[model samples]
Target: MKSSRKGLEICCGITATFLIVVALVFTTLWFTTFKPKEPEITAYPVGLEDINVFSIFFVRNITLNMTITINNHRNVGSFEFKNATAYVNYRGGVVAEVPIGQNLVPARGKLNTTTSADLMVGKIITNPVFFDDVAAGSLNLTATAALHGKVRLFEFVKIRATALSTCDISFSIASRNVQSTCKSKIKL
Candidate 1:
């Protein structure tokens, strides 16, 4: 009976040590190989697709074209974006909303997406600041994009992430030129 008890204790000790070693190995691997990295996002104004400012009393329309770029920096993970949306605003008012749909960005890859916004020209022109900006020969707009998705590591592990990007675009009406500045962030 004494010998049997000693053997049982030895087996428990070995099993405990084995479990500790396996946990340490997995922790090290997680830190070194499976951690998710933030992605870079940028927006560029492609052109003004259409603009109608013919009359002061008549309703007008404006269509703006733009492109968004997503750069994934991770070497071992890919991103899957689902049900994203991009919004265009003018002087604190939302002018348009564009759907980005779904996309998959491979590891260390870049994705360029394009969108078009149909501005609510009737609403925009009614604002007091609209005439002032038109007189100045430029229009200032803001573009915001929200992406909700998951970062997949290997084939089975997925981490939920949300990415947001905002850009300030200045359009020169006379020359049809565009200048923009953008900022981006990601949360996991």
Candidate 2:
């Protein structure tokens, strides 16, 4: 028939050019070995706001105002803050452990930072009062950061405390196991 129809049109154009070069080498090896994984969060995400100690006779050096609320649950990117380590406790010990100059929390939004510590109210205990099981007395702020380079991302970044969330003390003590570890007053 003309040479078998030109050998069946050159074998269908060499099998459609070898299936388009094997589909472009499997789409360039799946876009260069398929990459898209970089997120290994470090730490720092424990918030619950409201922490005011501007005055309570805390002499020698007093100034502590903490208003927290931060969240950055990294999924595949976003991370910073090469330094931070703040821990101010009470009743359970650890009065202070500050070192959060601030900076770093923008991968998923929800930011708010205002930390300052310099208390010396005689190491608080005289006019002390935070006896809500020593724990619910709140204000256990703990921060630790250093997520600048890695690839594990966040699973659930956190940061709580939403403005004077508690502790509105007003005690004039009278002794006799007098406890006032206030931590349940959120009017603002």
Candidate 3:
């Protein structure tokens, strides 16, 4: 009777071991066939084209103007520029950094915007003013555009999110010193 009991115990142990092995194999197969994939990310650089100082005038005690235009050539997702900030310098001297415009850029397309600021310009002479010392000037513009949404993933899926893109550039200001000078002296 004792030997019979021992044989039954061994059989039970072997059956339990076989069941555990089968369970492990099934779990492995399930995980390998049903796990989610990681997200795919792609980013492109921004470029500038036809950047110009659109207009310059004194608007309510400030020398205000609209400046900057950009061309985005991104092949994926949506690109939007909500606002932009840039700076201008006169002969390497920091002059101003003004906020441009609160504009929107369509998804996967191009856009143009403006940056406006108020400045203090005091002229020394108004009537036939003959000034001699007029130096050179430079402008360094930087812009930030907020990007949202995502492009078609693998020709089927769509991944969406919000991100930001920034651009910095420097260029020479042409004919900046020879502009019309009034009789007021600049107090800067």
Per lDDT, the best of the predicted structures is: 1
lDDT of 2 by residue, 1-188 (tens): 99999999999999999999999987885455422222222222222122233334445645555444444433233334444555554544555555555455455454566665564445554425644423333323222222222222353533221112122222222221211222211110
Positional deviation of residue 116's Cα in model 3 after best superposition, in angstroms: 1.8
Best by TM-score: 1
Model 2 TM-score, 2 decimals:
0.22
Model 1 backbone overlap count: 0
State the displacement of the C-alpha of residue 3, model 2, in Å, after optimal TM-score superposition. 3.9
Predicted candidate 1 versus true structure: per-residue lDDT over 83-134, tens digit per residue = 7778888899898887786999887789998877777887777778988998
- Span of 10 residues, lowest total lDDT, candidate 1: 48-57
Instruction: List, residue by residue over 1-188, the lDDT tens digit for candidate 3.
Output: 99999999999999999999999987885456322222212212122222233322332223345433333333333333334454433333334456645554344455554445443222211112212221224443333434343434234544453444344434344633212111111110
Query: How many residue pairs of model 2 clash at the backbone?
Result: 19
Q: Of the candidates numbered 2 and 3, which has the greater TM-score value?
A: 3
Task: Candidate 3: give the clashing pairs.
Answer: 63-119, 100-115, 122-184, 122-185, 122-186, 123-183, 123-184, 123-185, 125-182, 125-183
